[model samples]
Target: MVGGVKEEYQAAQELLTCMGANVVYCGPVGSGQAAKICNNMLLAIGMIGTAETMNLGLRLGLDPKLLAQILNMSSGRCWSSEVYNPVPGVMEGVPSANNYQGGFGTTLMAKDLGLAQSTATDTKTPVPLGALAHQIYRVMCARGYANKDFSSVFQFLREEEGQ
Candidate 1:
């Protein structure tokens, strides 16, 4: 995403497009950052929701793969469920399948959520879910998951089950 004076953005748009980048002029300065913060907040919330749902489904004897498929085909479908499912063995070539390594780290997610929290507070927006997601990521970072993929929230929830 690009954010700046409209003319500047328009000037760079063609070059960005030529580089095979999907560029969008969000608006004036700082708008791109705002958009990114909002997007990441939603992404974090979605991942956590997917993790919780997968865990509950497993506890209820539903197959992870089947549950994911059902969710994908239903109104529950989301990027988290369809593209970056948090359940191991539910999808291949994702951080979950590879043991939650080499993807977006929990620490990074926590930082982004922190920014989201600050932004929400500044804008006086009530982001209860985003705040909760921020807290969850903060706890994950403190529980030795700082280096793990954000999707490892599934593992975190599973471990919590025994505690």
Candidate 2:
């Protein structure tokens, strides 16, 4: 459910419906933002986990393409691993294939993760991974990859490991 000012909510619902989005009214003013933060937090975690797994596979003598196929067909499968692989050449027409450009930027992802962390802290939620993901993105930003796609975390990790 999308929560907002009544008129604005109705207008938003209409626009979303027109755009083929399945719109539902969530609750109150901040609920939509809350949902968005939660989604972004999970997405961040998935992307980071996928990157780490791919890197580990590479270090263990697994071919990137074969490893990706294995992961996609197994329990390790995720949107990041199957659809938007972080490793270059494993997929085509994604941010990673384009030098990590023109996709969700690391700075924006960091901001979303920060929002999730703030909300989690306020609610006393034990979001260990979310907090860690926030720190990782913060470090990425500090190391000059803020403008790159968030999946570029793979690159950051690879470089740090001298891979």
Candidate 3:
């Protein structure tokens, strides 16, 4: 009765949970979704902050490549700076080099952040970073790069700075 196929989504989710299948990678309202939502929020915020930091570097006359190199070697570096530097010509491994191709799509990121924000609102949890991440993602979609890698947020920053 509880595992009816009509709404098999939640029913299967519960059955798996009861069976100790905590490491699931898909389906609705599972741990995977939770992890995805949380990490996307973190990733989005990281991209935003990385963009701001890179903006500062450009303003200071530092070559993005040089700044990226140092950031990769230092505590200031993160996944965005080291593995996914958004500035073209700064990093070789990121999708940004090929016009921001590959990596997580921005539309999915925005959706994840929006989901997290809604969950936070329902739970009365304050997630300012998540909210800001959601808004920035909206801008990315508005700018027509929502299909690019989430790291494409750097492009948004560069545009905002009048460069």
Candidate 4:
């Protein structure tokens, strides 16, 4: 949670915890937002990378399930590649397997990426991949995938390739 004074921060955290939120006490008023921005930035990049990898694998005639398994077992493994594989049929019970519903929306991802870009600019930090990811999500939003789960990036990329 964001801060007011120490007591306020602790009180808010306690309240959030009582509400079943896994409240992490970020230092200052903006630090919680900063932390969330960073997290979503990384998540956007990972989701995009996972989609690209899966698309490439499919184009090369690799089985989607096998490719996802290989990626999960190899150095390429990440949450996106393993727990939330973007390719349909690669994993069940995730957004992709269910038509990209009921997960983090692309519009929200874009908004978070925009926040990351703004924060990076404010800090004079270089975030090349993060910037690219922001643009990707922005485009996805413009293309009408705003409300879809972010993992629908796989479908977006596939449609772009005329698959």
- Which scores greater on lDDT, model 2 or model 3? 2
Off by over 4 Å in 1: 18-20
Model 2 TM-score, all chains together: 0.92
TM-scores of all models? 0.95, 0.92, 0.79, 0.92
Pairs clashing within candidate 3? none
Tens digits of per-residue lDDT, candidate 1, 26-116, equal 9999998888889999999999999999999999999999999999999999999999999989899999999999899999999999999
Off by over 4 Å in 4: 1-4, 19-21
Once superposed on the true structure, which residue ranges of model 2 sit more than 4 Å away at CA? 5-11, 18-22
Candidate 3 lDDT at 111 equals: 91
Q: In candidate 2, what are the lDDT values of residues 1-163, reduced to their tens digit?
A: 4778778887677677886567767677999789889989999999999999999998999999999999999999999999989999999999999999989999999999999999999999999999999999999999999999999999999988887
Which prediction has more favorable TM-score, 1 or 2? Answer: 1
Best candidate per TM-score, number? 1
Q: Tens digits of per-residue lDDT for model 3 on 1-163?
A: 1222336656567766776755344534455666767777888888889888988999999998888888889898788887788898887767888888898899988899989998888889999989988998988898898889888888878887788
lDDT of each residue in 1-163, candidate 4, tens digit only: 4544667877667667886667777786778788888888999999999999999999999999999889889999999998988888888899988889989999999998998999899999999999999998999999999999999999999999999
Better of 2 and 3 by TM-score: 2
Clashes of 4: 0
Could you tell me the lDDT of residue 123 within candidate 1?
Answer: 85
Estimate the Cα RMSD of every predicted model relative to the unseen true structure: 1.5, 1.8, 6.1, 1.5
